[model samples]
Target: MTLEATDVSHGYGNETVFDGVSLSVSTGEVVAIIGPSGVGKSTLLRLLALFDAPDRGTISYDGEDVWRQPEGRRLEHRRRIGMVFQDASLFDASVRRNAAYGLRVRQSWPERIRHGFAQLVGEQNGTGDAVEALETVGLADKVDQDADSLSGGEAQRVAFARALAYDPEILLLDEPTSDLDPRNTAVIEDAVLQARDRGIGVVVATHDMHQARRVADRTAVLLGDEILEVDRTERVFDDPRDDRTRQFIDGELIY
Candidate 1:
């Protein structure tokens, strides 16, 4: 599967955020969007996640324009994609419950009732895929703890686990580890690579250049309200086609 944005442009009223942006990510590939803060990276991810419509272009999944589809079809497309935001907006519930939230909401009401009854009777813990996802984020032991009591980094890990539990075909992350410590950041990066190995298309919008180099198969540079370059990770770092890309990679370009 491929998730693509073609000639995509967006803005807030009269102020344009980005224009004429085109990018694609295929299954089993990781694409990184790198830019300084406020460069519209988050906005681009939102468009790719099907959370918002592009003002002047199309977002396509498998060659079909997503926004042009009927609401039911668009909804099905959204169900196949998962997004993790910068903030870990977890509910005031147990870690296990939070991790399984995505999957739970997608279930039929009757199924949810059955599961609830099973949990009540001790027939199941209701962990299901949440256990594996939490383990991937190194939080398997914290499954029964209150999500509200976790540290910031732990909370973010829970958020990533929640997204992973649904087994999305496309995963979009927006600066998921910006505030995490090195150890926690490494865990998240490993989970990302695992997702890629499972043939999931991953697009990560990150300010961490080192993280991009470590995890992305392809890197794209967004600057001056446009995509300046997109190429293999090593080539983008060592031999950027655009001087601006070189400047950005060398930390010489100031936002």
Candidate 2:
């Protein structure tokens, strides 16, 4: 029903990042976490996506604590969530191969069976799903191209396409369009909106307030180990209740 974190706390060694941080995103909603650099935005995204466990607190899906699940169950749970980083690292193989790699690694019985069948038939390039994912990101024609030869924007889109190929229930984006031009950013934003339309809960960690305002239904402002406020995007931008939120919105505070 929803993805949530309650009183989540984490740090490396003696350094504390945040404590008692709670956040949630319901299906079909996009929640943006915005803050200046080194404010634990990426760390929180990692926790939400189950890439890292919190030192304290729980991350739950549909009221069940995922971290407490058995390791196999946890891995299964992670399959329902996909994460896209700012860098969007891609392999040097063809885009189709790179996009389908995740599915191969997370192979369900049917996928394994199908892959075996494909190998038996000498049809190694059954990339229908990957091609469709690329089409979603406006790169259908690039499926057979070498991923390493792509431009920055194209490569990032391919990374997003790869995540989409699995059709995850939740999509965690960490500044996915930070390095793109306006056109490419718009393309990525459209892809995100399309994902939301398909009932995927989206959590975006961004430093760009404008991007948050554009894509987020709600926004959580993170600062120095705390979420100062989380509210509807318009309200958070136009009439924040917290002075710190207002200051951050007004560019008075830098981080």
Candidate 3:
């Protein structure tokens, strides 16, 4: 599934954050929307996630305009495009239940239900195929812990695991590692790459340029409330094409 935002103008009341902002993300690719705090990076992600509709613009999935679709269609669209918030909040339930939250079924046999996560990550001991998922993000040991009991980083991993568990085609990340230490950040970074390997297109809104350069294939630099530059990670870091983008990287207020 591909996400395309075209001429997307959005804001609340008199303040317009973005205007004529457009970008595209393809499967197996990771696009990082980078900018300073409170610059509408998260707002743009919300628009792409279909959580909010733009005041004047359109969002499309594979060329089909989503804003034009009905509410039911929008729900289905969201199901296919799973979202991972900064603080990956798992329910107050068990780890197994939390991971299997995406796989919940009303008619599924109760006995076979818990087996969903087990099936995804085989051979219990938290050492099965699901182990691979956890191991990918260095969270293999906390598989049995309750969601609320986990640390910030661990909860985020569980959230990623849950998203993978859902097997969505598109992954939307909003400041996914704003709280992690360097060690934990690397682990989650690997997990993001794993998602790309699985052919899931990822759009991440982040403040960490280092992480963006490390994980993103393409970087979309948002400035002046619009995408100022969209290019390869290396090129973007080495040379930003926009004045506002350069100012952002240098930590200088554009005012």
Positional deviation of 188 in candidate 1, in angstroms? 0.5
Report the candidate with higher lDDT, 1 versus 3.
Answer: 1
The Cα RMSD of model 2 versus the native structure comes to 1.9
Model 1 gets an lDDT of: 0.93
lDDT at position 13, candidate 1: 96
Please provide, for model 3 over 1-255, each residue's C-alpha lDDT reduced to its tens digit, 9 standing for 90 to 100: 688999999999999999999999989999999988888988998898898999988999988899899998887888788788887877897666676666563225764556555666763432244445566667667777778898788888888877776678898899988998877777778889999999999998999988898899999998777788899988888888877788888778554
- The model with the greater lDDT, 2 or 3, is 2
- lDDT, residue 209, model 1: 96
Tens-place lDDT digits, model 2, residues 1-255: 689999999999999999999999888999999999889999999999998899999999889899889999888888888889999799878888888876777777887788868856867655677888899999999877898889999999999999988888999999999999999999999999999999988999999999999999999999878999999999999999989888988999965
lDDT (tens digit, per residue) of candidate 1 on 1-255: 999999999999999999999999898999999999999999999999998999999999999999999999998899899889999989999998999988888889999999899877866555679989999999999998999989999999999999999999999999999999998899999999999999999999998999999999999999989999999999998899999988888889887
Off by over 4 Å in 3: 105-132
Worst 10-residue lDDT window, candidate 1: 119-128
lDDT of 3: 0.82
CA error at residue 3 for candidate 1, angstroms: 0.6
Residue range with the least summed lDDT across 10 consecutive positions in model 3: 123-132
Local distance difference test, per candidate? 0.93, 0.90, 0.82
